[model samples]
Target chain A: MSERLLTVSSSPHARGKQTTKSIMTDVIIALLPATAVGFYVFGLKAVILVVTGIATCVLTELCCEKIMHRDVTIGDMSAALTGLLLALNVPVNCPWWVLMIGCVFAIVMVKQIFGGLGCNFANPALAARVLLVASWPSHMTGKAFIPVDAVVSATPLAIIKEGGDAIPSALQMFLGFDGVYGCIGEISAAALILGFIYLLYKKVISWRIPVTYVATVAVLSFCFGLSAYEVLIQVLAGGLMLGAIFMATDYVTSPATAKAQFIYAFGCGLMTVLIRQKGGYPEGVSFSILFMNFVTPLLDKYLRITKYGEVKK
Target chain B: MEIKKGTFKKGIHPSYNKHYTSSLPIEIMPSPKEVAIPMSMHTGAPATPVVEVGQYVHLGELIGQAAGYISANIHASVSGTVKAIEPRLMGNGSKVSCVVIENDFQDAPCENVEKYDPETVSPEDIVKIIQNAGIVGEGGATFPTSVKLSPGPDAKIDYVIINGAECEPYLTSDHALMREQAAKVAGGLHLAMKVFGLDKGYIGIEDNKPDAIEAFKALNDDSIIVYELETKYPQGSEKHLISAIAGREVPSGGLPAQAGCIVINAGTAAAIYDAVTEGKPLYERVVTVTGSGIKQPKVLLFRIGTNVNEIIEYCGGLTDDIAKVILGGPMMGPAVYDPNVPAGKGTSGILCLNRADAHIEDPSNCIRCAKCTEVCPMGLMPMYLGAFSQKRNFEKCDEYNALDCIECGCCAFTCPARRPLVAEIRVAKRGVQALRKKRG
Candidate 1:
């Protein structure tokens, strides 16, 4: 017989069915519930914002990869996931140019510049949100709109910032109805929670970060001399659910050990609670996650896991 | 001690494709026209070939003598003429001295081989019987069994453990061995108990094979206790098996006897019984040939030095779509680059895998998901270990217990990014060793 061809590879011949593309697709599927909810709450404007965010990010990623002579890995869906996340973190009526700039920065600058996906030192969406908030404060804060019909009256956190008197009822805050003013994805705690369950079921993400982060925020906010309803409001209000479930748990900027993950999530909750209670910001989710992102490398380095059957030195 | 549920923590449930060959009884393959027997089957110094070219050798005659204390003797599996003693490719992809023999088709036995009764033999004599049989661990780890049977003066060997976990996917040789030859397996365990002068022996079988478990349970009595382990990959790993059944840790750079345990394969135990009772050398073994790429999947009792090509053809030849063929269990088996390789002592399975099963994805960057850590049976942070390895950060890799990685491929298998976890960590281990050697 003529020499037959064969493939030589390392041991562990089989791989699990999940791929990077499949995992990113799972993340996209998990976000669909919140995306649908955002459309219902904010109408067609939210759809335009999402499509623009997705298109700009995907375009920016393709251009950057081509310019850098790198393999075009936009098909991995990571850029799409980043785009969806960036759109969810901004207002439904965010200006088209502002949204495009955020997408460009998140994809080309924050992610691609750092060698893409896992190499980024911070969450691309959160960093871009930070950049946008810093750049056009009035446009982001709704002060530029200044019309009762132009925007929802006040965010629950905005009401709580002025001593909690106008804070909506617990059920209303949880349902995120009656013109609840927040980012497109962050409005409905109920829909975001459904996404969280979907993520858990698909094994896309673990329960550690979301559970620990939310519990830390809820427990600490209760200790700030607020009644049970106000603490429930704090837990359900403004980006707390969305940030804890999605942003704080971004795999790229997170710790690589289970115990360190708990510590990282705890740090996020503590920072968010501290910043909300004492700092100038009314919502602390974005900055809290961003701050924790910078702390990820240190967490991974210092928190070396003691291996199984490893004896004490 | 009563086990409420026998399990070692944090392991993956890989698809145990044992069904392909588990029900089949062992059939001895017809002797090939030519057999290439490698001199080095067991670990340690490669055996020194005592027989020269053109010498007449009988079946079960010593052709290669043990070169060192840690090595085992090699015997001819077929009655044949020594056509050549030259270097040939072994299953491990190494060029070694192989005794190329032309089979005479006469199953002639050597007259000098002797058998001893277990009742009449002393503990010291029992070790000699195993050594004379040229038996080594058949669990794909070809450590000389005589060395393991005797753990030296420093170790107090209290427990005799038999490993029947066979947790690898697409291999069922050990399970079939245990099922059909339960009496031989039990008798072998008892002989090992005699060698160790031990009162208790435990056979740890993964609970997936109810028939094997039932067969072993039927032979269990006062001295022997069979425990059904939780079905998990790498559950059959020697250290993991000892830990799961004996509740002891063979520390890094340590032996099982250091933890008061002597672990043997259930197949090895049966081989020991045959050696002690009938003076049979380690010649033939059970091998499972199964995968989607094979036309037939079956277990065969094949003689050593049999060409892997003959075994494949006997299994109904390879399907046209076959891409890779592994020489052992899929999880830890070495991929053979050439079909000319012969079956050595450690080959327990021949997997003819399809393209989909054999293809490696273009690995993406590690997402730091830490699922590697979650499913690590060795409790290693493979995420960081792989990163450190790729960075050539050998020191950090060591600090993260890179050497402790059992190379089970769990991290890589579960990685959504498809990072080469085991392959990278293997680099770190080699680098660490090179560094240590340079320093020394």
Candidate 2:
């Protein structure tokens, strides 16, 4: 025993089975339902856009790390997740070149430029979606793309914004049935809910952010004089489910403590509702989440958890 | 006999690999050829050597005297001739003065050994007896039991809780003790209650050890309420256990006495019973020698001052790929570089790990998954503390209350990036303490 050289480090000689790579893999698994739904609705064009987006994001991450003389970390699957999320945020009929550009902006400008992964101040996918919406309005809007020979139509939120009553039925909006025009992943509330359930089951994400975000949106919509039916439509329409479940809950850009997370989620919901009701754009998930992402550090700093056994002042 | 299950919030459920020795009856190991008793096993000033070189010291004879108000006396574990009193390596990688003795193989008892009448023993007498017996906490903290028993008069102590919650992974010494000697453990709690002038007491045990719980329940001691706690890592932590059983939180930076509680380990309680009833000194304790790296896993009543290497050999030696040997449970145990370090009064488990089990993956960027904060029992944001500490920003660490961290390793254990969160926080804690000291 004396002759043997032992590895002596700090306490906790054991570690958990979950690693960064494993967690990313779980996230990727959770996104499969939404991706499949996107393919079903938009056909081969969606697949090509997704493949190009993933390839561009992964390659951008690898190239950035190499240029920065850092360890190549694409194996952690973070870049792949970023790419998938970015792809899902785009219109299904978006050109492969436009999707590639969005993936590069997500990985390089929003993510890697800020030291990558957890250091990113804004969620890469949301940031890229905002950039795409700003740069190529014709390609990024809900009315811009015709999905697989379907007639072009305004998204449910756009119809609501225009004070129109002839919107898609609740079931059509929930299931993203044929001719319901929207971004690839945000079209189907059912598919996003399925992915959210998988994430919850795997402990990949907690219920605090998504539950509070969507609940706030629903409650605020009712307070703003929308009828009960309209409130239900508002909750299920557009990217509310997609953004609340996947984007607003981005671990790196969200507050860590439960109390702080609630406040941040509420802020996101408030901003999202305000923008949808009064702003120029018909959608606000990307902007709302990006705004809350910038405010995350402040929330975490000010709303520190009441430490265990902390005496009341 | 219906026990209520208790738990603290925000703790993690690690894979408790206790099956290796949980069911094994404790077998007494043969005394080694020589014993090297470190003078500073307890958490205080080191004992001063009283026995000289070449002196023949009987078993349980006083070899080192408590030098301060918060130290424990040291006794010879075997009847032997003193070989040397010099600095030697300890399991935690510190060099402390040790009294080395060559065993004579003759079971000679010290002449001062005498039983006391528990029925007539005064509370002060009980404290003195515990001090003389050199009984410290056997729960790895090694705080002097006498000091804990003698909390200042101002403290409004109400409950005397016995910690039977062996929640650390790969450690079952307390479990074996509660199973085989439940009465002694109960008797020890009774004595502690008597000292505190309390009639009722509590014993908190993790629900994973149902047999141990049944052992105490079979005693039908209504005064001793045995709680079945959720089997979670660090459930046996003193503050958390106090919270779980007594429903009181020891205020931050305050002792358990502040919460009207005094928690003692089950092994410490049993030792108290033995010291009062049979006039036995705390020279031996049950140690769980088990891990994937060992050929045979067993619970053994090992003599203090025995070489850990010899104990490993007694357990059929190490497996071919044994890479690390830790002196306590894997969660908070320090891995030893020198396997020959003598087991001390606080040594509870000897966990040996194979190469695969011992390998630590290289850390990547912290994904800020908040898993650490979620699992932190202290409700601290360990990710921030770790990052601030790594960047040498001690003030931010202080502001975040890094000192409140119990160093239970929950953050590091559950970290997705394999970041050494606790290790960095430990450095920050030291830095904060030094800065405060300098300011003072």
Candidate 3:
């Protein structure tokens, strides 16, 4: 007689080694290099903001899961990532209340409210950033983005808005040594680029959106009469790198088709330029990405990769 | 005429497990003791078995009868004695009535097995011959070839596109066949052209298969356009290939014939060649038995009804702890619980993956990464379909174009979040299909 040694599911019988925990774990690991760089660039303040954001996000998520009577998904670290991203988007000196509110928006409103992680129709952190920007424009503006040993001033977009003559040096802007003060994530171009490179190396993100987004912005900005250097500075400065690499490239919130993604990124660029040149906001990466995120699904519907062997009249 | 190069789309390059068996040549397995011929191996109506139990059958003799316009006849692969008539697992895991025969080793005489002159045959004769030959698309879709060949007069088929674009990973059966049987494939194309009365025929092969391209080029039939396709997942898809090579955009929700074109798989073409030329019926097909977990990956010329387990055993058995026993290529194949499934006309690849290799994480919430959208070949929103299906909202599934999904696994493969997209979307498809049936 065959002994019943162990109860096991039969073939397919097996799940791939890639689980939610593993994917979330990989994402956290990929985000670490950038987190460390942010900490280094902004000192202990950056760490505090990140810790606060993570705490609130995790707390909000746990609370929501409990109320929803769903299994606690804190183990997935998705909440942690959302918190980290939200924290990264704000000013390093942002009050704990601001971080908490952003965390609530990202975790409770953007992510969990829509059914968590992949189900959330938009990138939680990006949405939260946009929400925070819209709700508290003064706080979200370039008020505290000063670099270590640099004079605090306006961002290039802000400077252009006030007067193009008042803009910071191209080198300073490129190196994130701008005289302006801004959000927690916007001050360090080098740090964000480094983070972007790390994420690329980790394969956490593909280069398509970031490459196309920055290229489109620079090309369009140049074609629209902005000096080539200003275009480069604009591309390198502010939240363009942050939004392009971290926020705009959010897999779920972006357009699905390649052509659609290209258009989405281009749309983001166009919106950013319009807001900078004519609209009220000096920098529009946050709004542009969030707006584009809303249209991603529709874009995907209209633009799709043809099914193999799928022919039509 | 136009050779498309590499592509940049939302596609995944999963381990090209093709590296394992792609270099291997096609080998004929010794004839099996018994063969099971299923009538419903193709996409449409199940064929009706003509022979009774205990009846003797010769190689190439029709054992099953086509029931409708979409069905194809099933022929005996070997001279055998009908052992049993019962339900058996055909490729795609569907249980259908199959005629089981025990090989008699006599190789009994078959009827009308001869090569035909494509140039001399009239289009009507070609159609009748194709119908009699029981040839169907053998590219795993198993669509009846004659019905596709019989283009309506209003929808004049101007071009015959031979799909050599075996875009699925790890399945090199088409590649191996194209490399080895170029003449047979081309002859099948000629037969297709004659039947359709179409002038131009293009063989679309992916640029990745250099050897296969060279082989077709050497065949040098001026009428056959050996166009190299860009290396992309689903480039072999009928619409994408037509758009890529023929420069004709299939109108949304339209058929290829509506665009004055007819597409046939390279394997299907070879079967057509055999059918008209040798008067042989489609009883056996080439299958690529491959995966990282298998000990030896190879393209075997397997007879229908040969058990998958027997083939696996012949292939040196499992290399790792088996995770999945899929009946076809991973992208579109259905997972099977039992390895006793008999190979059929549509059984292109049998992927045996081990635990570490085949594992996918429990699906989490959709991040709305749109990876599903980016990689979706049908351009349908898989996320909405999956989300709505999870809620059992079949109506919303319809609204999301769940019917448009080809179930190509690209959404699941490229998803950063390990979502069971294809599995969920399939539920939605079934739901919609059921509702449509209810309404009808």
Best by TM-score: 2
RMSD of each: 1.8, 1.2, 4.9
Q: Write the per-residue lDDT of candidate 3 for residues B215-269, one digit (tens) a residue.
A: 9888767777788877777777777777767677566667788887889999989
Alpha-carbon shift of residue B173 in model 3 (angstroms): 1.6
Q: Give Cα-based local distance difference scores for all models.
A: 0.85, 0.90, 0.76
- Best-to-worst lDDT order: 2, 1, 3
Q: Which segments of model 3 are wrong by more than 4 Å?
A: A1-41, A55-72, A75-77, A95-106, A118-167, A178-180, A193-245, A248-313, B1-12, B111-119, B392-396, B434-440
- True-vs-predicted CA distance for residue A178, candidate 2, Å: 1.6
Give me the TM-scores of chain B across the candidates. Answer: 0.97, 0.99, 0.95
TM-score of chain A of 3: 0.88
For model 1 chain B, give the 10-residue run with minimal summed lDDT. B1-10
Q: What's the TM-score of every candidate structure?
A: 0.97, 0.98, 0.83
- State the TM-score for model 2: 0.98
**Which candidate has the highest lDDT of all?**
2
